[model samples]
Target: MVKGKIAIRRITSPKSRQVTFFKRRTGLLKKAKELSILCDAEIGVIIFSCTGKLYEYASTSINSVIERYNKTKRDNQQHHVTAAEIQFLKKETESTMQQLRCLQKYNRQLMGEELSKLSFEDLKNLENVLEMGLKNVRSRKDQTFMEEMRELKRKADDVEQENVELRKKLRVLSQDHREIKGEFAAETSSSKEMSKSSDQAMPDKDDIPERIHLQLSLQPKAPSLDAHETEIK
Candidate 1:
């Protein structure tokens, strides 16, 4: 007879461990077969070795056993979802979501404000965007003003040059006026003397056309420099 209790410890020696494993494995398989045949028990046993080799036994055909188990589970009102049922549920969910979107859109149209769903945070974000746009507009306006100011300053410089030329022309006209006055005085005296000596009178003053010129002070023309021009030493 076997001892009252065999010490349940690992068989340390390699050969001894292997022998124990083989004996236990055979005994377990035998007991399983006996239970299946004598007691009509539906049994499935899976055994693995330390090296990961597999051994399996089923009292009936594995497929039939699996099918019978599934049927029994269903009869007991198990809530497990089969692969097909899971796929069908996924499709149904997608369809429901699509319909929900259409209904939500229609409801929003009836309500006349689709943006009412936005929360405070969403409004704040929108406000920030609008503020940024306003800031950008102001910045662009300032930049445009600066550019226009620069152009106006350039035009003012040109006007100043034109004014200087006009001043020069005015000076020339003043000098000419003085010369004309002096010539008239000399002619009057000389003509009085000639009348006193002869009957011929000084010629009557005729209308003389004076030509006025508009002088524009232009910047000196810069010499054109060709891109290919180079000094070779």
Candidate 2:
């Protein structure tokens, strides 16, 4: 005979409740295992008894299933973080580009190149900024001019020092030339004095008359023209 269906209510007897829990747990695990095998699906189930006993079923290792679930969760979190960072950076870049474009537009307006788009007040403000810039530029130009002048003055001082040194050298050379000329004149005078002394120390012809006569007597006489002609004959 077919058994009548019993209503799913709490069992009054502790023993009956325990028996029911055991039977239901067994049936759930058998169905999970069969489903996994038939469908080639990964499945995992975990249950805890009132007495703190653990019951579980998994098509694969329970640890492997748990590890895979955790990994998938972590990857999803990391992907979200990366997407958020990328979006933030894109926004930051766009904001910076906008600021740069604004600055460039302001620069063009300041240079008076885009005056048609400017109001009178904007033009006045631009004019004031330009005037200030012009003043700064002129001040810098004056400072540069002063610097160049100072540099030229310093160079002139250096050149003057060189000129002074050259003049000192010229003076020294002139003094040396004068001293050499004086020495040369003194040498010439000394030579002249030595020649005069040698001439004076020699005996005069008049003072050596007897000596001169002896010299003449020692000389050979020239042949007379008449004697030469007789000899020739």
> How many residue pairs clash in all the candidates, one count each?
0, 0
In candidate 1, list every pair of residues with a backbone clash: none
Residue 119 in candidate 1, Cα distance off native in Å: 1.6
lDDT of candidate 1 over 1-233, digit per residue (tens): 87697689977788988888889999998999999999999987878888788877789876677788889988867776688999999999999999999888855644445768877886677667768978999999999999999999999999999999999999999999999999999999999988877644433334122211222224365655663365322
lDDT tens digits, residue span 88-153, model 2: 999999999999999999988876687897888988889899999999999999999999999999
Q: Where's the lowest-lDDT run of ten residues in candidate 2?
A: 76-85
Score candidate 2 by TM-score against the native: 0.50
Model 1, position 168, has a per-residue lDDT of: 100
